[model samples]
Target: MRVEPAALEQAASKAGALENELRSVDVALHTTAAVRGLAGWETARRLEQVQSRLQDLVTGLANRLGGVSERLAATARNYRDSDEAVRRRFDDGR
Candidate 1:
């Protein structure tokens, strides 16, 4: 099974980008005060609860993306190391 380290690296880069984007969105959601307008109605309370849940979801997704990126990068490194080891052994045998 041939593993393309470059392809893995590219996927890792994309995952990292998505993680950053999600983090940014989470930050925007948390920092915006417009959602907490001056209203004590039950609907406003429900809206706050929904917003909180959405923020949590975004945070969780970002965390997962970060984990995926890390794993992908590690896999790519491992593949590259294995390839280098094989090449070195082949060269030594020549």
Candidate 2:
């Protein structure tokens, strides 16, 4: 299989950007969840619950994106390292 280090790095960058965007949404959800009024009302309680669930979902997605970014970066590094090794071997044979 052919590995394109640049492509992998670009994908990693995109994943990182997506993770950052998700984190921004997570912050917004946190802020919305912090709103307080009629704490004893059933509707308010439900709204809070929904907000909490949404926040959890967003956080989970962000975490996954971060992992993907890390893995892609690692893969790119590995490919670059191997390429360098191959180049060195070729140079040494001269």
Candidate 3:
């Protein structure tokens, strides 16, 4: 079956329009994907920064706790030593 000249022209025009539409769709998809990728990278970077800050806070807290613990331990030792001395004096008087 032979297509008329007018029918052939119309078909070619439709195909061209469809081709242009497909190209536009592809460009839009690539642009959206790139934006998403950039956003993901930015999010990851921010998260890493937050994690670093949290680690620093944790380290500082741990150091402060260690210092406090050391001070308490020394106080306890001094109290024990003083108590033993008093006990010894009392026992000698008995």
Return the TM-score for each candidate structure.
Answer: 0.87, 0.81, 0.49
**Model 1 regions lying over 4 Å from their true place:** 26-38
Root-mean-square deviation of Cα positions for candidate 2 versus the true structure, in angstroms: 2.7
Worst 10 residues of 3 by lDDT: 22-31
lDDT of 2: 0.87
Colliding pairs, model 1 = none
Residue 92 alpha-carbon offset, candidate 2, angstroms? 0.7
**Candidate 3's residue-wise lDDT over 1-94, tens digit each?**
4324444444545544544443344323334545456576876566556656665665565555555545555555566677789999999999
lDDT of 1 by residue, 1-94 (tens): 8899999999999999999998888543553464456376676676677788888899999999999999999999999999999999999999
Q: Write the per-residue lDDT of candidate 2 for residues 1-94, one digit (tens) a residue.
A: 8889999999999999999998888544454544565466777777777878888898999999999999999999999999999999999999
Q: How far is 39's C-alpha from truth in model 2 (Å)?
A: 5.7
Model 1: lowest-lDDT 10 consecutive positions? 26-35
Ranking by TM-score: 1, 2, 3
